[model samples]
Target: MDNRTNLDDYLAGLGISDAEESAPLPPAPDTTAAPLPDAANESPKAVLERFLRGLIARIDPELSVTVRETEEALEAEISGENAARLAGRDGRTLGAIEVIAYTVLAKQEGRGDLRVRVDVGGFRRRQADTLTKLAERLAIGVAKSGEPHELQPMPAAERRVIHIALKEHPDVMSESVGEGAARRLIIRPRHS
Candidate 1:
């Protein structure tokens, strides 16, 4: 008739009790647990968009950026009176921003090689296309004259575009030479 129970006796009684009553309540079955996120469907483009959103949120709370994915990479287009500030001198700022954005997205997606391109007012795309055409023209000239044509020194990315554009050329050969700031592409006639 006495319902009073000591703490040690209560614990011992539970231990001695059958599993149906004392087995620590079986953990409640976890019905309200959150579903795992669908990272499998996530792409480099989505990560890039999220990264740019974060950057804009921190740097320019009032400014908005639009992101698009081309066939090869992610591109972000931003506009504002301070857009030039983001673009920097000859787009150096934009390029630096791009490196940071790519790093962020790569880390988020567990990727080491994510490609991201940040541009202001379509400058980079225009520059790349124009440089590609120039390379093609120079390659044609070198092919016709059978003499090596030296081009102005360019950054690694531009040089890479030139090389890739001329990769299929049957009449000319493209080679990058020199050191540091002096490096340039030399287009010459292919061997007969």
Candidate 2:
């Protein structure tokens, strides 16, 4: 029994006629979705500052702010307990605020796709140091054993730090994998 005959026998067992099995199907409809806009050109930091400002305005019209744009990002200080509300659960509130700010800024700036880092109460800074150390430790382990090591999931800024810090090490390579909240970094020996 040839392969086609075996397939026919299998389909016949399922009670489908040859005509039905051979029926012409419409070409897989081109379901290609639109591509997302690029994020590199988006000013993620400035948008975050605007969001913080909006939150501050709602909390207290008298509140003032200080906005500082760094070469890599932006920072804003609301200067009171109002900042506490934005801080939210484990800085999650700050993360949400930052995302909203980025979305608004990206759209208003005609950028549909850009990521911005937002931090409140120095949360991201501390996280950077921690991620850097973890990356360094894994770099050593990977260099010694030549086995890939996957770290826990982290937000974008932390992942950036890991990528930057390990990028200079000649013996190791790091890249992010996974998606959404589960996204993480895998450090491994670069191919020779």
Per-candidate local distance difference test:
0.67, 0.63
Candidate 2: TM-score? 0.60
For model 1, what is the C-alpha lDDT against the true structure? 0.67
lDDT of 2: 0.63
| Residues 1-192 of candidate 2: C-alpha lDDT, one tens digit per residue | 597566445333322224233232222224332222233343455334434544555555555556677665555665554545556777777776666555555544666555455555566677788878988888888999989998889887778899999998988999999999999999989864
Could you tell me which residue pairs clash in candidate 1?
A: none
